[model samples]
Target: MTPSVERVAAAAGAWLDQAQRPMVLGLCGSQGSGKSTLANALKAQLEKDGRRAAILSLDDLYLGRSARAALARGVHPLFATRGVPGTHDAARGIALLDAIRAGQPVILPRFDKARDEPAPQGDEVPGRIDLLIFEGWCVGARAQDDAALACPVNALERDEDPDGIWRGHVNALLAGPYADLFARIDRLALLAAPGFAVVRGWRGQQEDELRARVSRGEAQGTQVMDEAGLDRFVQHYERLTRHILAEMPGCADLVLNLAPDRSLKEKP
Candidate 1:
């Protein structure tokens, strides 16, 4: 429905036409930045021509709370705190991707936010598929060095003393076992909001609405972060996003700026 989203879908569909094999498109953005919506819209474009498209959110690969706790004790404890590279089961995720591309029925993992755990047994199915839409706040957002977090977040710094700390273990995960696989990105589309303040505001409102959904039991184990809480959470993402926000202008194949009314503007 959104023109910006429609543009991204159209671009992706055209790019995949020349692929010798299934193309893996990465939709990267922060939470509430509309990554999933774009993914669905892109799939629609692919399906319109009777082409095959499959979507797999990196969010679904989040490591369980217990595993995260252990990673913190051993790897980076701070990573266990929230979304980051170490938060996902990269091995399983990579294998799943391979399965989907092979066109075998595959059952992906499901993460439960309430219980903070993954389904004991993953979805049972085949591993066959076509275009794999892997999306998330940190989908294609790369890992950053520890020195990157030395500086405080820009918006927070502008407001006052920007003392919030966002450390990255993403660099760790990327350089680790998943390094080679992550490099296979056929294309990456990043949705960049104007500023962290705007991103935080949008995220806060989105979470509040999601909480209402949870209250109504419309969804199970949904994520809910409040204004105060999101402030803290954004600090974590900000440390890692400095590079993303900076590189978005030049790096993303397509960049969309979202208006307050959810209107799309192509970033030139």
Candidate 2:
């Protein structure tokens, strides 16, 4: 683990020490802001301290392509994309958390973004978990008020959702099921990027690395995005990303501000 990750983990461990057993830690951040990386590092650190830890990602609970297609047809066309609220199977997420809290064995699901489908079932945990790290872009995000959703955040909303149908729907999901899921978290952390403008570049860098790995035969049959495609793809998440940026820091238990270059800027 990097020194920064270790520092975050150390503080997180201190917080966990006072919490109840089978604690759920929610790590929220923008796309490519290193939430997953921090979750994994914390999991390792917790294990080193003789605690069994498990990590769960909200991405893995996303509705399958076909389900999202149905939502697109019934709700709004933008629902066809996976990043926004209303695109995840919230019932499944709740069930997984219930099982973990009940001390039952559970198998996490993994989503393959490259193929736009559920990849495979993750490893099964046979007993109660000591710590559960749940990470995602909007993990701890709250619903924006109606007035906040009045103006379109980007071209995607301006052009495709002039009537405010899509954003309104997403906000409802956040106010309901997503809020319930987040309420189960015992502690919450935020990886605050310098600003929303930095997200596109960070995500682009991730795609570049994916493409390089595919070329070296480390990844096969992956659906990598080109620069233009990446830009459009991120637009779907712009509104909520901005909302989290503005709101989550104040509510989260720990906030790690990240610099434009993606390094840890300030400790919590």
Candidate 3:
């Protein structure tokens, strides 16, 4: 692990030491902000210390492509995209967390983003987990007021969703089920990027890595996005990303600000 990962994980481990039973840690950040990497590192460190930990990603709980397509047909076209609030299976996520807390064995769902569908059920996790690390791009985001939704944040919104229907629907999801799911977190941490502009570059780097894997015949059936596609794809997340960047630091229990190059600006 890099020194930054080690430092962040060590601090998380220390926090877990004093935390209460059945601890749930929420790691929130914008796309490609290293939330998943940090969650894995924290889980590894905790396990080494003899603590049984499980990592759950919100991405894994996203609605399948067919379901999203149905939603798009019924609600708004933008619902077809997986990154927004309404696109996740929030009820299932709540039930999983409830089962984990109730001491029932649970199999975490895994989503294959490359294939745009849910993967097979993952290995069963013991219900009596000592720690659960839940990570997502908008894990701790709250809904915006009606007045705030009036403005378009980007070309996608300005052009495709001129009436604000899509964003309004997403904001409603955040206010309801998403809020309930996030409330399960005992402590929250944010891996904050310098600003929204850095997200496209970081996300582009991830696409390059994915492309490399595909070229090596390691990632078959993965639908990797090109530069133009990636730009449009990220537009789905731009508004909420900016919202979280503005508000999360003040509310999160811990905040690790990241540099433009994706290095830790300071130890958590």
Each model's RMSD to truth, in Å?
A: 3.7, 1.5, 1.6
Off by over 4 Å in 1: 120-127, 145-147, 152-168, 219-226
Task: Give TM per candidate.
Answer: 0.84, 0.95, 0.95
Instruction: For candidate 1, give the lDDT.
Output: 0.70
lDDT of every predicted structure (CA atoms): 0.70, 0.87, 0.87
lDDT of 3 at 90: 96
Minimum summed lDDT over a 10-residue window in model 2 is located at 3-12
lDDT of 1 by residue, 116-227 (tens): 7786766554544458888877666655566664565556433433342224345666567556555656787877766666777777778888888999999786668767
- RMSD to native, candidate 1: 3.7
Q: Judged by lDDT against the true structure, how good is candidate 2?
A: 0.87
**Number of clashes found in candidate 2:** 0
> Candidate 2, which segments miss by more than 4 Å at Cα?
1-3
lDDT of 2 by residue, 1-268 (tens): 7755776688777876886667788899899898898888888888898888899899999888999999999999999989888999888888888787676889988888768898776778889987888899999899999899999999989999999999999999999999998888888888898889999999998899999999999888887888889989999989999889899888988888888877877553
Question: What's the number of clashes in each of the models?
Answer: 12, 0, 0
Candidate 3 residue-wise lDDT, 15-113, digit = tens? 777865677788898888888888888888888889888989999998988999999999899888898998989999999888776657899889887
